[model samples]
Target: MGIEQKAGNMGVVTLKLEEVINWSRTNAMWPMLFGLACCAIEMMSAQASNFDMSRFGMELMRPSPRQSDLMIVAGRVSRKMGPVLRWLYDQMPEPKWVIAMGDCASCGGVFNNYAIVQGVDEVVPVDVYVAGCPPRPEALIHGIVTLYEKVKEEKMKDWA
Candidate 1:
């Protein structure tokens, strides 16, 4: 429900679990570190002092998939790595989100042969697609902010 005015100074408001969960999720997103190629550098820069991803509540990039809820696929995925990607995604807990963090991760980018998987979505679902050969650190922040907006609107019925 939208914000409402309290009848008195007692201070009480009504909201659903999904809305509360979404609020917590957006503010405390922990992205799994799963970079695969050149775009990985840009992804790393996002965590550095200059960009400071901690401001967005993501200071520590989790190396283990089980401990994180957000996944930033930061490069071109290869056909050989498809199963690994899927396995990691499977390992993450429910209500997780995925960000395809570059043209390479979103699509095949420059590589268009049998080696490249064409897109990370081909292996696992993508929630936000950050567009660029290797999108700048600022762009990554934008993507995170965009995901936060999306999370803020989610409902319990929307999940499986």
Candidate 2:
């Protein structure tokens, strides 16, 4: 017999399972432990209490890019460090997301010197840009949520 005939309702069961899997995947965003400047401090603060980034399931900050799914560029990108950043970004696994977590990472901030890369977008494709000299914890949280929304909106076939 067909699935519809064998079961009173197979659709609900399939949907429930898919919902569970997607919920688990979206909630767990393991960010790589990389901080280049002052904004790094803000990133850490977001993970700490008060702001409590753990509430959104991003508390586990992985030290290795191989294990991380999210890369939070939390500072200025100097010419000397640009190559290193690119190398690290390339190391991250598939389905990865990049969060430019400050004006420095997003647009070079006040450091207009020739040594700066102007913006990290020049090195990597950013998924979200969190603006601020040093973006507040709330802003970082919002960026993560936005990334989650994007992940949800993406078509499954696109990943294939």
Candidate 3:
């Protein structure tokens, strides 16, 4: 009743279900096609041929919130837009993650005023914060890798 006896020569590889699930989730994260301000350009650059986000398995951004598992909030969030942002976050399926890209999105950047929300976290929970006026594409990639690591370490109980 051992694995060796069960698969004498057929090359059967075995792994924990949790590990497989985590691996799949990390590799094929589809981000929502949403942006608000300047940091969005940097986000697009990350998707360009030079940076090529495809290598990480995200070939394109999904336009529908329902189809996206990741949301990159690239730029400042206006007070008026807070409810809209929350609505979109709520529309997304369960087990979704958010990245506040750039200083503007993370903490309202230089536009610290009543019109600005001060931080995207005020509207939605952010899992990672990429700090910069508009973070470089490399920095965005680094943030993504960091997020991947976080996702991979998730346990089934946490999901529950």
Candidate 4:
């Protein structure tokens, strides 16, 4: 009843440029569509109509790293595959993020062998991790939301 009443319903609002930019980034993040193992299927399910990740502004799963801002490492990273994963991560634009999905990707799951990379964090920095052998689509969605919240609180100094 204070500012709104004085404005007479006029479309007027105030926000810091940092807030505006962060909001935009959170709403339009394009995830990379690079799948490595079984968890890849679960990742795809999040994009389907049932889970419907598009509503969160992640409808497009970019196959090209150049077009992506988020990298969802949905499966385990083998020792042999570590280099490839890092290469792909390096290809994504700045202000990028990563989600380690599934137990295998997070900590090697049952594969405690040298061939397994132990955790994808060894290959690329993970921003959020969704736990489970192959996490349900809902879990993946939650991780994305968590990332969004983190992005929203980012400072201008951090972007540089």
Instruction: Report lDDT per candidate.
Output: 0.90, 0.89, 0.91, 0.92
Better-scoring candidate (TM-score), 2 or 4 = 4
lDDT of 3 by residue, 36-55 (tens): 88989988999998999888
Tens-digit lDDT track of model 4 for 5-121: 886787856989999999999999999999999989988888887999999999998999999999999888888899999999999999899999999899899999989999898
Best by lDDT: 4
Question: Which residue pairs come into collision in candidate 1?
Answer: none
Model 3 stretches astray by more than 4 angstroms? 1-10
Which residue runs does candidate 4 get wrong by more than 4 Å? 1-10
lDDT of 1 by residue, 102-150 (tens): 9888988888888998989988999999999899999999999999999
User: Against the hidden reference, what TM-scores do the models get?
Assistant: 0.89, 0.87, 0.92, 0.91
lDDT of 2 by residue, 1-160 (tens): 6878876666654455445655777799899999989999999999888899988888899999999999999999999999999999999998789999999889888999999989899999999999998999999999999988877776655666
The model with the greater lDDT, 2 or 4, is 4
Prediction 4 TM-score vs. true? 0.91
Ranked by TM-score, the better of candidates 1 and 2 is 1
Q: Alpha-carbon error at 140 in model 3, in Å? A: 0.6
- Native-referenced Cα lDDT, model 3: 0.91
Better-scoring candidate (TM-score), 1 or 3: 3
Poorest lDDT segment (10 consecutive residues) of candidate 3: 4-13
